[model samples]
Target: MKISFLLHNAYGIGGTITTTFNLAQALATVGHTVEIVSVLRHRERPNFQLDPRVGLRPLVDLRQEKEHPQHLRPAKVFPAAEYRYRQYSELTDERIGACLADIDADVVVGTRPGLNVHLALQAPERVARVGQEHLTLDNHPSRLRTALRRAYRRLDVLTTVTEADAAAYRRKMRLPGVRVEALPNSVPDPALPPADGNAKLVVAAGRLVPVKRYDLLIEAFARVVAERPDWRLRIYGKGEEHDRLRALTESLGLSENVFLMGAAAPMEAEWVKGSIGAAASNFEPFGMTIVEAMRCGLPVVSTDCPYGPGEIIEDGVDGRLVPVGDAAAFGAALLELVQDDERRHRMGRSALDNARRFAPGPVVAQAERLMEEAIEARRAGRPVSQDRAPMRQILVGRGYAARDAVHATGSSALRTVRKGRR
Candidate 1:
């Protein structure tokens, strides 16, 4: 099978890009031909290391695209929410169609909402169209939501990272022909060894965005520092919230103990240096970082966020979970782990055991089953199954509740529609 992955920007380092690259490589290794098609290329260097077997193509050089002079009273940035709506309204050229003409793949998967709508609406009739969502439906703007409702009815399968996200789409869009599935992100196992001794260090990593809530992590760490002055916190990754978060750290007099360690290359190496991992997000569609840390044998302390953390951590077993936005509770949890060396080691060992479920081999096998199911359903002119493996069954078996069974079964059931080749 020839599979084409349509991504918004393949040049950047993001969870969506990393997961797509990993899945594509796994599919290729299993004897399927895979190609990546980027709609916009922003940088000369590819941030992800693609499998040599995978083919890569770019449709538009965004840097080269003509723009109005910046000296003029600047309108909002291109590709802003308003600009995306305007682009949707005035669909002048069929860029997606032109790109599809360049490839003869059995399946074409779109990685984001705009690309999904474009592929569903514009692709020829010979290619199977699959739309994958990395964020929740509630995160989309109203205009994009409306467009998805109208355009997605034409798509074969609509995939999201979480079951909660897929359910939201079903309820909000109310589209008949669309099938929603949950396909969480997967990462390769870490190659590094765990730290031998207590590093007295906690690590947090992600883009410094509002949703990531790194400020919350800093505040929580400040409280932890008050109790255990020897422990330190290090946050990796750079983004818009850098200045504000830095200022907050200084205000709390945590600048010395809490270091904003900017973006690090090969993040897995950084995880090895920490005694524990932290994920302080308001909502995580799928907490890839948490799993990454676990894979590196670092016990994690994450918030009981809406979808992912509860699924990943087996509270008091592999890791601890505090209520969302509760900095005090988060601090106490970290401090407890810091003070108790034996508990941290026990939890770290358990985390490694729990992470096996998300190992690339199992994850790719699940993906292959989903693809086969979608293809068979499409050929038979039937609807793909949207019923998920029960979270309760998975959690109960693992001695977890609804909130602590994140790693149970990360499977999705998206339908595939094939468009005829020109």
Candidate 2:
């Protein structure tokens, strides 16, 4: 079977790109030919390692392509649905549309909302179009959510990283026949040895964005520092929040202990260096790093975020979960883990065992089975149901209502979720 994945930017180092490559590599290793179609190429080479067997096809090379100077201009057709829509241009629409129209793959899965919209509208009907939701539906802007409820109707399957997000879609959207399922992101076993819970270190990694709430993490880390002065905190990744977070660490007088380790590759090695992994994000769609940390035998101390962390961490067993946005609570959890040697070691071992459920090989195999079923169903002439045509309404009185409240599909009908990602 030939499978192609549509990604926003394969060159970037992110959870989505990392998971996509893992799935592609796993599929290729299992004898299925895989191709990764990157919509935008910003670097000479991808930040993460790619399997030689998986082919890469870049739609737009933004580097130094004199022939396609239009790549430098802004996209006119890029939907307001994406927060980063301004970065795209009219050329992106043409290239993505053309690419979708021409690809001859068995399945073409999209990794983000913008690319998923293209797959819904332009992908060939014979191919199975799967829209992978890497972020929670609640995080989307109202405009984007409306567009998704409409555009995603054409997809044969919509995959969310968590069951909670899947339930949200089933409750809010009215996709009559489209199957909505939760398939967690995969994390391969680390190449390095697992952590032994002896280091006085705590690690957190992600884009340095406000949504990640690194400011809160620094605040919490300050309290942890006062209690355990010997311990160190390392935050890995580069983003716009770098300068602001650096200043915060200085203002709190933790400039020396709390170091901003910018963007480490082969992250598993970094994971194993810490006795405890930390995240204080306001929200996490999948908490991919939690699984990565767990796989390296380090128990996580994370915020019980709405969509992911609560579902990933088994509280007292494998990891500790604190109330969201509470620096005091988050700090207390980290300090408790930092001081207890025996408990930390026990949890770390349990975390490593739990992490096996998300290994790429098994995850991809399950997804491959779903794709095969979809292909067979299509060949059998089962009509893929799409959303109803749009209906506009004018409110003259005190009347406000949620869209599709009555037309929405029941959660029980859509809970055939395959497996937990973390």
Candidate 3:
């Protein structure tokens, strides 16, 4: 079967891009033809290495399309809401519609919400369309949420990284024809050995964006630094918040102890040098960095955020979880792990054991099953097994609110009907 992946930007080093690339490669390895369709090609070069078997195609050359000369700066001030809306409309008109009309694939999957909306509304009727939501539905703007609730009616399946996120989509959107499935991100197994000699380094890695809450990590690290003068904290990733975070570090007298290492390539090697991993995000849909750190056998200290960390980290077993946004608690948690070598080692071993659950093979197998179910439902002109009454009851029993359970069940029913027809 031929499959096409639609992504916002494939050239950058991000969790979504990496996961899409890995999944595409996994499908290709199973003798399926896979192609990546990037909406915007901003750079002449790609930062993340992609599988050679996967074909790359870019819809827009952003650099060439710009009108300003080298020294001249483009207008930076614009209404955020209006600008986003305009960009979404333009994507549908200029790229998405054209791509759908040209490509003849068995299935097409959209990797983000904007692209998901496009795939559901613009893709040809003959092809099976799937929408993958990388972030929780709660993070979406009001307008986009309404659009997705309506647009998802056209999609065959809706996938998210965690059960909590899926439940949020079901509750908030109240949409039909959506089958929310858990498809967590996977990483390549680490080649480096676990940290043997630790200089008491704690690492956090992700885009230095507001949602990541790097500021909170810095505040927490300051407390750790005051107690253990020899320990250091290293944060990797580049974004608009660099200067602000640096300023905060200086203000906190953490200029020397906290290092803003911008976007480290081969992040696994960096993870191997750390004794502990930290994820201080306010809300993380799924913390891929947590798993990456665990794969390198580093015990993690993460916030008990909305969806991911709570599900991934078995508190006090594999790692520790502090209350979200509590610098004191986070500092205390980090200090506890940092000071105890035996406890850290025990948790690191457990973390490595837990990492096996997210291996590519198992994740790919789950994806394949969803695809096959979609195809079979389309062929038979009947609802898929996912829409059965028992499943609906189970979702309700699992603590999903009443209204959400109804919406999810209805969506599953619709998906079965639409897919069964094909």
For TM-score, the strongest prediction is 2
Candidate 2 lDDT over 1-422, as tens digits, reads 89999988899888999999989998998799999999889888999989999999898887754246575676644567787786677678889989988889988898988888888888988888888999989999999898888889888888898879988999988776787877778887588899999999999999999989989989998998998889999999999999999999999999879999999987988999899999898889989889899989999999988788876778877899998899999988988888899999999998897666677644664576567766766667574433321111211111312222211122222222212422
| Candidate 2 lDDT | 0.82
The candidates, ranked best first by lDDT, are: 2, 3, 1
Name the regions of candidate 3 deviating beyond 4 angstroms.
67-92, 387-422
- Residue 85's lDDT within candidate 2 is 87
lDDT of 3 by residue, 1-422 (tens): 78899987787778888889879988888788999998767898678877889989987667774332421332121112222343333433455678988788878999887677778877876677878988888877786676677778778888898877877777777666556776777777577777653658998999999989999999998888888979999999999899999999999999889999999876998999988999999999899999899888888999999888976777787789999999999999998988888999899997886676565655565676677777666556554455523433644565544543433332234335545776
Alpha carbon lDDT of residue 128, candidate 2?
85
Give the per-residue Cα lDDT of candidate 2 at 130: 86
Question: TM-score of every model?
Answer: 0.85, 0.88, 0.85
Q: Report, for every candidate in turn, its global Cα lDDT versus the true structure.
A: 0.76, 0.82, 0.77
2 or 3, greater by TM-score: 2
Write down the lDDT that model 3 would get.
0.77
Pull out the clashing pairs in model 3. Answer: 177-411, 237-263, 377-419, 377-420, 378-419, 378-422, 381-420, 382-420, 383-416
Badly placed stretches (over 4 Å) of model 1 are 66-93, 195-197, 380-382, 385-422
lDDT of 1 at 320: 95
